[model samples]
Target: GDSTTPDAIRTRTLTEETARVFRSRVVNPRWIAGMRKHGYKGAFELAATVDYLFGFDATAGVVPDWMYATLAETYVLDKENQDFLKHANPWALHAMVEKLSEAADRGLWSEPDPELMDQLQQVYLDVEGDLEDRVS
Candidate 1:
């Protein structure tokens, strides 16, 4: 952080780095497509990553509301992506949506769009219902 020249001082903190990586990887279409190629395990990784994200935010207070929205819009809500998760691993689908719902409920997504959150709630219920059908 400290540097001889004022201009040379490092500017990015762990918060920025975390957000950057999340945008480049998690919300990147190419990365999502790549994950789709890996099938069940790929979906599992995505779901698990959300858990890690939530945990990190719980401790660091760095995750922005937009990041959660991106995860929902780009990953969970997109039809192709949702279908991929469904066929590859419905459990992962359920797990991921559950985490998102928890995040919103906990105020991580403090000012989420009403329409978007409404859709997410419906998706969560549908995913849970899908799981219920399989086990029953």
Candidate 2:
């Protein structure tokens, strides 16, 4: 008999499992809301997690492009989360946006949505101006 088992259907590919975890837990609305409840510390953790995702994908060839795209959409580009970070910790927001953009620029998210990139660039500019103003 072959080594393949009937339960092979339950075995998800690396990408599929990664996507499942990311959507169900990492980017879930409830999880995001819960993180936000912790104040600035929560915001910092969110940004740090993004960096970790980026790093793992950079080193290992497992993460799919859509994961990055969806994460950017659900976390950084969402207006509600954007507003929260802008007020609670603009620097974290800025870093998140910058990392996403870097991911795109490096082709980690090859063929990223043009419109989303445009929106992110605009947000980056606005956030940069605000930070500069605060310094001035």
Best by lDDT: 1
The sequence of per-residue lDDT tens digits that candidate 1 reaches over residues 39-99 is: 9999998898889889988888788999989888877899999999989998898888888
Error of 1 at 59 (Å): 0.5
What shift in Å separates residue 70 of candidate 2 from its native position after superposition? 1.1
- The alpha-carbon lDDT assigned to residue 62 of candidate 1 equals 80
lDDT of 2 by residue, 1-136 (tens): 2236775546676667666778787898998999899879888978887887788778865667788878788877899998888888889889988998888888777788898889888989999999999999
- The weakest ten consecutive residues by lDDT in model 2 span 1-10
Please list the C-alpha lDDT of all candidates, in the order they appear. Answer: 0.86, 0.83
- Provide the TM-score for each candidate, comma-separated: 0.88, 0.85
Which candidate number has the best TM-score?
1
Task: Score candidate 1 by lDDT.
Answer: 0.86
lDDT of 1 at 18: 80
